[model samples]
Target: MGDSRPVYQRIADDLRQQIDEGVLAVGSRIPSRSELKRTYAASDQTVDRAVRVLKAAGYAEGQFGRGVFVTDRSPVGSLLRTGEAVDSPFAARLLAGSSAAPPLLWEATSTATGAPPRIAERLGIGAGDRVMCTRYEYLADRRPLQLATSWEPLALTEGTEVVFPERGPYARRGVRERFAAIGLPVVKATELVGSRSATSTESQALGCSPGQCVTVIERTHHTADGQVVETSDIVLRADRWRLEYHIAFPG
Candidate 1:
């Protein structure tokens, strides 16, 4: 823990490190506020404040009946190619002046409550299943670029209790890499694209106005057996981040 920060901040940072280090596995439940208070020897309000810090930093979320759970996904380091060939017709038009590097603002846990009903069904889990989620705000040359969110099924990550397990569901190596390590290699992915006005939270995260339009990319990942393993949503500031797709002509 860094000495320059406050005790609560240090506490939060330690928890974050544990998550990043796989001490806390994705989708695993965290100790209750009272438990934290007892462990940290702090007041209830202090523990609550620390938890809120974790949430804002994208480490955990509070589920009504299930308690707080760690999110599984992490931020994407590159935007150019996600191990998939670009072949969409609008590929050229989307890539004009789009750069690969984007500054990161925040990457922490996000609640899965806002997902559309259809997406919930596709995961083969009820709307109530604890999901490990991550959110990132991308910036180019210090300006807002894009915002993205990714989610993974908790059931797939059972037994991994670290906030960000080193070898569980969606670790630093990504879902594909983690799955492969566990003998569940991903073979393909299907993506859906669209656009919409920025929600209040999106606006705050992306540093954009509420009415500004944003690009939305929803992807469903599958394994060799065609089992849908995970789903992700990438939202970008329409004016800043542009999508580039490389197409192969079938002559």
Candidate 2:
């Protein structure tokens, strides 16, 4: 029973349950520390500890002066699944900081995982091979925007810690810059776009309503030599993002 757990653990568990039950949907503000202390009849330390636990577990996040709030629960794939490839040009233009695009915030993380079957096939490697994975979550004006994960062969990344770099490549030389340093320069990319419903875990991350649709963008990058060096899958929130593409015609 929750009662047997530590008071802080119990409080965290209760909050987690609330989130799972939709009592605290995405963007919902949580009680202040003092309020939580009073409600739980616990000390400030206990309440603070509970909040920290929740945050560490990715259930909640703190906003300066605004207190804590529930995280978005939308899945990352909702934004790219529309059978619409027409927006690729527009998205590319936006990535290029073209005149018509708005500014955005992008965060990236690199990880190492035992290659899953799907990823292995994409990289022409065996399943369970060690692989370096880079995840990117892009936001526009602090809203849930787009999600992407890129995978590379671990052998190719030896001597370079692409994943968990001290300062993310995006923060330094940018994604292209970092890859270039490792001799994996990207020359061209092919994409496949589709849609699907959000998984429970993805729904929690994207802060979307249950059963909401999502977009998925799968991309494979090739070097100038035509070697498939990296593969990325990007998921996005459908409502929060728009896809735009440019059409070119020649006489």
Candidate 3:
């Protein structure tokens, strides 16, 4: 029976099948666009759309001059059981992989600005409250993998050495550690995970095509007395990353 799906979908499906079956090995270049068009007996636009689908899914990456190729099926970003541990830095905890690759590099920009209403609400502060907002991009081998925006109420850091997260003594430290430095220890964290279409800014920063779907992780950290200490919004390319959680059974 003929496939009921659109031609582009059929082409994408065939390529995806090959990738899943290992017929197209990781790092191996996929057939050129012209070649794929001829083989699929589809028009250039159809073939191009099929390839874009694969690219958006993170199954493939296009090289500027070289042809598109399969991407390694590796976890680009991870969440671990240690995420709630105060002594451990958040960035280090997430990037602690057994892979032989070098450590993930992060570029962050921080500014002392007023929190937006929604973020202020999450942080349990009044709307328009002063907050230190830091944006982060984590890259592996210079390839963008994760983006995050971390917020801390200025009340928690004012007059403290760790006030400016990227410039102060506690620069690059986790929320738990920074708060701990100021005698506010983070004892718990909650995260909400969901999916959404990437905004134009997100698409540009992540190198994903317009309207690509992404994974969203919203996290809130609490102090020992149940006060909200910090909150963050993290975004990752769904096609390029996977989130795994290790749930321990109670004794």
Candidate 4:
């Protein structure tokens, strides 16, 4: 019984298994190209391909001029989907379980831009409608933790005090309260989560190699009458955080 797989597949499988078993612990460098070739009795091309496979699948990442290393996928923290964090999501992201946590900080930029088609649909508006689009970056202990881009229809906030998400008195007040200021209280929200490869921009800001795995959450807030007030796309390094959703029993 032999593993008739190609050299690259075999190499990748072996290293992946090691990572799964913690033999190749996080932050530790994997065998170099020369070493892998020697051990597998394979050519340089085969070894290189194997390494590429590892990097592509998010099991490892390479530092500039440094060899490939196992990625740190340990649970750095948890993303709590409740309370004020939901109100001011633009401010902080990781609300991990009780423990002395790193100080959280964030930055955001908002602009009057045309809504992309997807966002337009989420807001129940026509494509190219003007919307106040905002981008956010969250950091903990000075390290990038997450990224988000939010879109709010200008038609809903044009003459209000909360037009800009990061400006004015109502800034960072979360959707419910901010909209409530204008007599448009948000009653509920919906979220959809999925996985994808990190884009070049995401990888750089999150401090991970390009093509690494990342999680994306599409969220929308609505009024009691089902009016869409805000929508956003949230992105974070998949290996670095655990997302928690608490459900209450209808007792």
TM-score of each: 0.53, 0.54, 0.80, 0.91
Global CA lDDT of candidate 4, please? 0.85
Candidate 2 global lDDT = 0.66
Q: What lDDT tens digits, residue by residue, belong to model 1 across residues 1-251?
A: 64787667867887888888999898888788788878888887778778777765556767788888885434323244344432111112223344434333333454434334666676767776666665655454565556656666756654553224233445455566666666668888777878887787886776555555677888777887777667877786654545655556788
Residue lDDT tens for model 3, 1-251:
97799999998899989999999999999989889988989998999999999877767878889989987755555544345442233343343463424466788888989989999999999999999898988776676777899898999888899888777778877777788888998888988989998888998888776577898989899987889988988888776566766576889
lDDT over C-alpha atoms for residue 36 of model 1: 81
Model 3 CA lDDT for position 189: 90
For candidate 2, the TM-score is: 0.54
* lDDT per residue (tens digit) for residues 1-251 in model 4: 98889999999999999999999998999999889989999999999989888887778988889889998666767677764466566433444462325677789999998988888999999999999999999877678888999999999999889998878998777788889999998888888999999999999998877887898999899999999999999998887777877777787
lDDT of 1 at 56: 55
What value of lDDT does candidate 3 attain over all alpha carbons? 0.80
- Candidate 2, residue 200: the lDDT equals 64
lDDT score, residue 32, model 3?
91
Stretch of 10 with least lDDT, candidate 4: 91-100
* Candidate 3 Cα errors over 4 Å, as ranges: 83-87, 90-100, 139-145, 197-213, 237-241, 244-251
Model 3 alpha-carbon miss at residue 176, Å:
2.4
Order the candidate numbers by TM-score, best to worst. Answer: 4, 3, 2, 1
Candidate 4: give the clashing pairs: 87-174
